[model samples]
Target: MQKKILLSYIVIILLAVGISATTFWNTGYNYIEDENNEHYIRQAELIANAFELTRFDSANDFSSFTKSYADKYNTRITVIDLDGEVLSDSEVEEQLENHGDREEVLDALRGEKASVTRYSETLGTDYFYYAIPVASESFTGVLRIATPFHEISNFNNSVKYSIIRAIIVCVIIAFLAAF
Candidate 1:
């Protein structure tokens, strides 16, 4: 009877640990994703405002500007015209293929802000993208910023590990109490 009770307690504690770990991971990842996505959207918006204030219309000038801003934000920035043609890019030295086929660019062309996480074939890793439409009296376009998913993934892992450690400590204490 004592053995049975101990086994049952162990099982219950294991189940609790597993459930709590899963919940912590999922919740942490989603929360981080949402927070960073919105923050990047606002970053794009602020850059768009800066573009509006500037008189630099040359593609080279725009590229340099975006490169500097991308460095400041620690993310890649790409400016695309309404037709999805890449006008400027912080990461790409050469011109990129038309972005019209991209979902975020398409959504922005349709006047909606878009955020997404997807694996980039070119980068060989997952990335989070946020696109914001830029409009001014003289020019209009889309500004996109991308950051690697690993940044947020690392944060999620840290949070989950912290919770898992707490759960382990609690389980140990409870098992001792069971005696």
Candidate 2:
């Protein structure tokens, strides 16, 4: 009877340890993803701020400014006018047909930062879209930036590896304790 009780306790403890380790790993993964996303968003905002300082003589001048600046971060920037027109874009020479209707741009037009994620048909993968209001006094155009999903996905995989390592260490400790 005593042996059976000891075995039961050991099994329960090992099960608990496994569960705890899995939980810890999942939490860590989520934290890493969240942190990476926040950091990238901040980087996007900094780019927007820099674009604000370029002193464009008119809205048309914004095209060259966005192209030159956004290229550094592997992102595409779209400058949208208050009327929802694409005033300038980093990737395309012609105006985007759906510029004004885009949610991120609309939110920026309302003086708010907006971000969204969606699958890109062109890239054959997902991408994140970030939009923030340009700090211009007269125009209410938005600066929308896009980054491919692989940026975050790669970071996520790294996070997953770290969590798996931690879980393995925890499982080993649990096994040692059981023995």
Q: How much does each candidate deviate from the true structure in C-alpha RMSD?
A: 2.3, 3.2
Q: Give per-residue CA lDDT, model 1, range 1-179, as digits (tens).
A: 99999899888988987897778678877887778777877887887788777776577778888998999888888889898998888877877889898888899989998988998776789988888888766568888888888987787678778877888898889889877
Q: Which stretches of candidate 2 lie over 4 Å from their true place?
A: 1-10, 57-61, 137-139
Predicted structure 1: clash tally: 0
Give the winner by lDDT: 1
Cα shift from native, residue 3, model 1 (Å): 3.9
**What is candidate 2's lDDT per residue for 26-99, written digit by digit as tens?**
79778876776677678778887787776778856787777777777777777877888878878778656767
Question: Per-candidate TM vs. native?
Answer: 0.85, 0.76
lDDT (C-alpha, whole model) for all candidates: 0.83, 0.76
Q: Candidate 2, 105: how far from true, in Å?
A: 1.3
lDDT of 2 at 5: 71
Q: Model 2: how far is 1 from its true place, Å?
A: 8.0
- Name the weakest run of 10 consecutive residues (lDDT summed) in model 2: 134-143
